[model samples]
Target chain A: DAGITQSPRHKVTETGTPVTLRCHQTENHRYMYWYRQDPGHGLRLIHYSYGVKDTDKGEVSDGYSVSRSKTEDFLLTLESATSSQTSVYFCAISESKRLVGEQFFGPGTRLTVL
Target chain B: AQTVTQSQPEMSVQEAETVTLSCTYDTSESNYYLFWYKQPPSRQMILVIRQEAYKQQNATENRFSVNFQKAAKSFSLKISDSQLGDTAMYFCAFGRGTGNQFYFGTGTSLTVIP
Candidate 1:
């Protein structure tokens, strides 16, 4: 509810195609994260950005990539999407690095890869 | 890697009654943080409560409180007065003080029936 928005609330695409998800924040937070949620798997981190041009891979980053050219925008791209990548993706932002655990999330984007 | 565990897959409580959700975590570091997040059907992740490792006193927010046992590495959430709106998927998270990553549990689906 902290001015975070995830585009493409729902998308269905064929496997082996490229896909991109966008996360925009109006608060200009210093930290941004992308997570994927699946049944019985809760949520797993895909990638995160500490600042502009500063990114890091998370536990489940093998099929995902991220970019942050500005403080308010973070992008997650899936190159040659696979059926395993179908899940609900969420975007979160935090104001302080010291309080990274406390994040504000946007409405998730549900993606289905066939 | 830090791990969070929520053994209970589903819980139900009557409206206006009290309920508790169990959460246990494993971490190698002495100092770390614990958190409870709520994911409604809308798929937005909301922070329910937080507990600091260094603090002995439990943290409370309105009808929500946490019983944090640092020695046992247990952090449970107590909802004093449950409501229908409280029905959601609750996730336990672990955040190491030195790392920016947050490890999440599989989640517990809570149902508050009136």
Candidate 2:
């Protein structure tokens, strides 16, 4: 199995609390992405990194931030947790760009905010 | 901006039967890629199949296949001999061939009744 792992498989936090989700990859892929999955919205990109220290915001990046200090690790942080931010977050890594390559995804982290 | 649409909110299929999930996308670029990802109750976003815009022939993997209509901007997923394990939320997505960003649809929930 291509190893992509997300930490804190499940988390519970209170409003205004800070939280961080970690994604680690055993496969050395150039592209890594963070996405949030919701009931009606399905999944939306939150952030993505092309290389170490290179990151960009996705469609739904507000209230969320990401960092990639090393190729194997990408971190997603919530400055102040909110109930609306409660969702399952996934980490995906791809050797090629989104259009033509296969993306391997982590199991996901379900975060619940109160 | 590109947009992916999954018109069907939910679909049901009998065990060992066949089912098709519909998806449509709008993009200006001629070269791109379409994808179907399955998210089970566990919430992991798993790659089901992918189709390149340049390829004329459809793509199939095991019991999963894609009907890609490049000109019509439609990409649909066909699951043959559907199993209970195949019951999950399927998402339609689009991405530029060489770009890292992707556009995703809401999703279609497929239920396999055994």
Candidate 3:
């Protein structure tokens, strides 16, 4: 397993409340990503960071935002939580820019928005 | 944009038997990569196997192998001598050589019966 950890392994928040999930890595990988997993949607990228302070939006980034101030950490925040955002969130890291490089994943965080 | 599709939502197989999971993808890029990931009840995502689009030979790992047909845009996983630990949700993913994001399929839940 990779030395990756996601804080607040399980969280329950009410609608319209602000929430943030943290992903920390010890591998010092150059790339980090955030993804949401749902019943019918296996996994949809929320955001990704190529380097410190360099980030890009993904397919389902409408309700989510992210920040990467340091190499070891990537954060995902929801300004106002929504029930539709209740799902399992995963963090992944890759050592190289090549697509063939294996991406290591964190255990995941289960968030429930009421 | 690239899309990965897993037609089988659920599959069952007896322990020690062989089972195959189907996956198909659509992409305009010629150079890319494909992967299969396993998520157990513990909610941890594990990389099963990987195949490079430019390679003509398929990739194999231990008891797991991938039948990658580049022209057909198909990448299927074959598990031999399956065990109970193999029971999990399997996902097919696509990644472009020059891109950072990955596109994943809905997933196929596999149950290894005793």
- Highest TM-score against the true fold, candidate: 3
Candidate 1, residues A40-105, lDDT tens digits: the string is 988999998989999999989998999999999999999999999999999988765564458788
Listed per candidate, the RMSD to the true structure in angstroms reads 1.2, 1.4, 0.8
Best by DockQ: 3
lDDT of 1 by residue, B1-114 (tens): 788899999999999999999999988887778899998887778899998898899999999999999989899999988989999999999976754678899999999999
List of clashing residue pairs for candidate 3: none
Compute DockQ for each candidate against the true complex: 0.65, 0.67, 0.76
Model 1 residue runs over 4 Å out of place are A99-101
Put down candidate 3 lDDT per residue, B25-63, tens digits, no spaces: 999999899999999998888999989899999999999
lDDT for each candidate structure: 0.90, 0.91, 0.94
Candidate 2 stretches greater than 4 Å from native: A97-99
Judged by lDDT relative to the true structure, which candidate is superior, 2 or 3?
3
Q: Model 3 reproduces what portion of true contacts?
A: 0.72
By descending lDDT, how would the candidates be arranged?
A: 3, 2, 1
Tens digits of lDDT, candidate 2, A23-89: 9998999899999988888789999999999999998999999999999999999999999999989
Model 3 regions more than 4 Å off? none
Of 1 and 3, the candidate ranking higher by TM-score: 3
- The stretch of ten residues in a row with the least summed lDDT in candidate 2 chain B is B95-104
